[model samples]
Target: MHMDEYELEREASAPIDMLETYYRALGWEYERSGEDEIVSTFQGSWTQYELRSIWRAEDQVLQFLALPDIRVATEKRDAIYETIGLINEQLWLGHFELWSASGLVLFRHAALLEGEDGATLSLQQAETLVEAAIEECERFYPVFQFVLWADKTPQEAIAAALIETQGEA
Candidate 1:
């Protein structure tokens, strides 16, 4: 199924409790890891999808963007392309990596490293990758639900519902 169509379907059919169950079944191991970074894995008949959360610290932004080594600076172009190439290689291998550097405000799909130093990417590019990954996972897994709890925040659940609906449209 196409990604937009899947988003619409997900938005329409996913229920809150179901999403909760999906998260819960992963167990404490997953949740513990999520504290630092969220990681989710799904296995279908033919493919496996692994979602990893990427984080960057505030001080690291300049260094990350400039493609600088911890101690010294070098030609930015060379570093950027090299980084992008490595990331592209990983994507071809079917790994979905999401980067959240400088708080949750900036989200992007790490598409490719541009130079020798790895310059991270912007959110739009990241979303493109994420959409593809989600679609692939849904093809085989099929089942989805919104997992909500009384004590938990409603925002994530709401987002999940919307995502499900968006899948169908």
Candidate 2:
């Protein structure tokens, strides 16, 4: 499946409420995660699907979306690839790839889609999401840069990578 490409623009910093409102206007449901994070869910049979945005201590904004299909827990290898393709196309991202351990599909900008790492969404759309997330960070905290990721699994490989790196260091 091939994903669609969209453009994202950065916006002024604001509170999560503002970001929630923006996404809500786009027909997404918002749920509060931690003190400075939010998970936005898209409506439809695609329930349990959510986008998470986190504001770090230094004001860095991290964003990503998770799409899970529990029914494919024990499917074959090719099925997993097909699932990845399906998600890539549905999200309209540039590219999608599979993760080894968790079997998740990561989406991001095509440039970052290399290796056995994350996937790539359209840089344009990512810029937009980051801009929104940045506004929320500025309102609630102090945000520096906006980081975004997308995956078909509920687990976050980026977070896992951070933890592993920290432990190793």
Candidate 3:
């Protein structure tokens, strides 16, 4: 998909359409609910992720969220929050957050549409944004799991997630 194909016709519409095309090219399952919102699914090695791309015309920003299949119980929120903080510090592109209301751990990022001439959005940028979200989420998924189920401390979970290993070497 090219920028011209995904160029915002009105600052509000068309971006989502471009996103739809992009996801389609990748053979990912997706549903476009509206001109500004899209829901997609990605099956990763660790888990299935629910991906969302929302375009806010008023703010001229695009929000991307990749949610792995994990939930934080009420008793686990404190530890999960701490782990998220540590994980976020290690991140350069997007950040992980706990959606308190839903108790869902999700990776979120926002891209600012830098111009007024109907925002030139390229597929490459979109892919980078989406990839960052999913990669970060997959990278630290075990951190959340260790804290919630294995009862590991935040520091320990972060350390486990960061350990370098040559598996099967």
On lDDT, the candidate that comes out on top is: 3
What is the model-wide C-alpha lDDT for candidate 3? 0.81
Candidate 3 local lDDT, 109-167, one digit each (tens): 89888665686466777678888887787778877888988999999987776673223
The candidate, 2 or 3, that scores higher on lDDT is 3
On residues 40-106, what C-alpha lDDT tens digit does candidate 1 reach at each position? 4545343444445433332222111111111112323233233333334434424312122311111
Please tell me which predicted candidate would have the highest TM-score against the true structure: 3
Indicate whether candidate 1 or candidate 3 has the larger lDDT: 3
Q: Provide the lDDT at 131 for model 1.
A: 51
> Model 3 misses residue 124 by how many Å?
1.0
RMSD of each: 20.0, 17.5, 4.0
Q: How accurate is candidate 2 locally (lDDT)?
A: 0.40
- The predicted structure with the larger TM-score, 2 or 3, is 3
For all predicted structures, in order, the TM-scores are 0.25, 0.39, 0.87
